[model samples]
Target: MNKGLYFWKTSRIPGKKQGIILAVLLAIILGSVSGWYYLVYIPHKKHDEEIQKKKADVANKIKKIDDFYEGQLKGGGIEQFTQLLNEIYQSRMILGLTSYDEKLITCKPDSCTFGYEILKSHVFNVQKKIFWGKEYSASFSNKGINFSGIPSNLKDNTTLTNYRKKRDVAAVDCGRLLNYIYAFNSISDKSDQIIIAKPPASSVLDVESEVKSQKKSYGLLFSTWSMNAKNDPIHIMSIFERQAFKESFIIKGMELKSKALKITGSFVCKSGK
Candidate 1:
């Protein structure tokens, strides 16, 4: 045998089993790394990102709330804000808006003639009321307006009832009574889930003539709407406060089996002599 050939023979070549073992070890390492990356690392990373994003969103909302109050002070107090909102809706300017009843954006002033026909027709007998005082053009709330529909604390109706009975009806200004309906609707438009079942026409409205001697009207309201929670359980308290905040409303009844709430209440829209 040649010297080189003798040396090669003495040196052991790895068997098939050894090669297979080495291959198996390599596969195990790669599998472990892939499993860790997909099962453990990826989920943790995604969860962290979600948490961070949620925090950012919450913070932004808080900042907006603070800014809303400060802006309200600068623009004028809540009473002025409320009155302006009522005026805007009453002008039928909101009707011309593309956003329409959503109340998200201030309506652009327009020359839409939808209601003109009603006013022009002689059959309608609409009386024009004029103010001799200075007419200031209407102002508007800040874009992204914040209306805090905070509910007032209430006892029983007896106290209010007694007070109204004792008080002279003639002392009340009818302007506030007319205004309350428009203002209340303005706030209610922003309530969640609660929506108009159908847009009722002028015929649906009950217009009562003023009594000659007393000259009083009590609780004039003509609106019908319905609500059912689509996804999560309804925020019952928040919805109630927003809807009922403008007036006195109570939960008249509820059917527990059907998870139904049957509520009937009237708003305060009293006008007196």
Candidate 2:
């Protein structure tokens, strides 16, 4: 054989073997890549998608709660109602109508006409009177403010008898009377321009005599009635008189003539000093 032919044959055999080895390595690399994509990468991608889905659900729930509160604020709920009450109170204070005044003003029926009208037309519901006493409670209703007066440990006493007599004499509905008392108390609580004198120790007759003797301007004589925790009738009397009376006179006038009488000098709202 020739030397050049022998050398070419030997080189060709090694080159074929090298090509087979390269092909096997390439196949192994491709198989590893395919296995990684199916087993590891695919499961990790699915887990990430689940995590994002859960986060979206939580965000949606939080948004729903926020919307509920926002609706309450805009729909004249408790917060709006409270704000309206504050405005009315401030307006009355500014106009010097903090207390109940029986006298009529030149411009309108009374100094608190605006407040009264607002209360009567919007806030005050006759049904709510059931909740005025200790045993009574109130709840909301579409028809109106519903109230239930639950009778507690009621007792038959002289004060209760006297209160019934007075109510009969005045010819006022029991519910209406309670409503008036509640309204008066509410207004009195919010008033800032009133002077309440201390109660007296004398009898009601003597107090009346002293008031008459003073010869000063007088206003409304407010009489309120309610029941105590023991279900006994409680009578409270408040005077809306002039501020000109001396402290001595007021103290004397605050005395109750009888045990059935209710008198508190703490609530004195004067119109003119």
Candidate 3:
């Protein structure tokens, strides 16, 4: 079958009514165009804007990670980022916008260095709060610990320093013992000795330093007379976790007997895995 185009012819109308009809038709066309602008164009424009924003955020993250790889991102990016990477396979944080961990001695493109801390004072300062002072001295099973020798928050750089010049940094491994004191951890003036053992001289020996595959490790062991206070000494500080930090503060063993508490833990003090 063959098909042919058909045409329709209409008679001419008056110009006055034609203008009104033309105006209506023009209004409909404009309305349709405006509708398209509001619906499709506007939505796509907004979507593109969101995509660009996301791209910008991704670019910022990429730059940060690049800085970290290039060793331009200093601070604890090496240590803590490595730790996060280990966890995520490990994971973080666009190399962290800001790194607060201070033990990272040096961060380089090829290799990084971490400063070590003698945790004797780290644990001792926390111990002093529990055992020192007139309030706590009276509540000790022994003569009580005299904290006159060491001030609070003083970390030891005894073997780690050079020629009497100590590394003046509050190490990343600073809060080894303080992690146990949940209630009194952040407080500088620790007045309450009710929740923990006394300041009966606590110490953490640097068991080993970091090797190729091996990281620096520490062993913390201390014994103190039970506090002559109202609360059960060890019950409040329920520190039974294997590792309080990334690779540090591993709870090894704990003992309590006859108003005396002994705490033993492995603080594998290192940058990361």
Q: Best by TM-score, which number?
A: 2
TM-score between candidate 2 and the true structure: 0.32
Taking the tens digit of each residue's C-alpha lDDT, what string does model 2 give over 119-154? 323443332121112223345444333222222111
What's the TM-score of every candidate structure?
Answer: 0.26, 0.32, 0.25
In every candidate, how many clashes are there?
A: 0, 3, 2
Local error of candidate 1 at 13, Å?
3.1
Please give the distance, in angstroms, between residue 128's alpha carbon in candidate 2 and its true position after superposition.
Answer: 36
Q: Per-residue CA lDDT of candidate 1, range 1-273, in tens?
A: 698897886664556668899999999999999999999999999999999997776565444433432221122112222332344334334332322222222111111011122222223222221112222232233331221212111222321343345433222233553354456556653323344433222221132232212223332222334343221113444445344233323121111122333222222223333
Candidate 1 vs 2: which has more TM-score: 2
Off by over 4 Å in 1: 2-10, 15-20, 75-273
Error of 2 at 237 (Å): 20
Expressed as tens digits, the lDDT of each residue in 86-156 for candidate 3 is: 33110112112122111222222223222222233233111211211222221122212221221111121
Cα lDDT of model 1 overall?
A: 0.34
RMSD of each: 22.2, 25.5, 22.2
Q: CA lDDT of each candidate?
A: 0.34, 0.32, 0.31
Looking at model 1, the pairs that clash are none
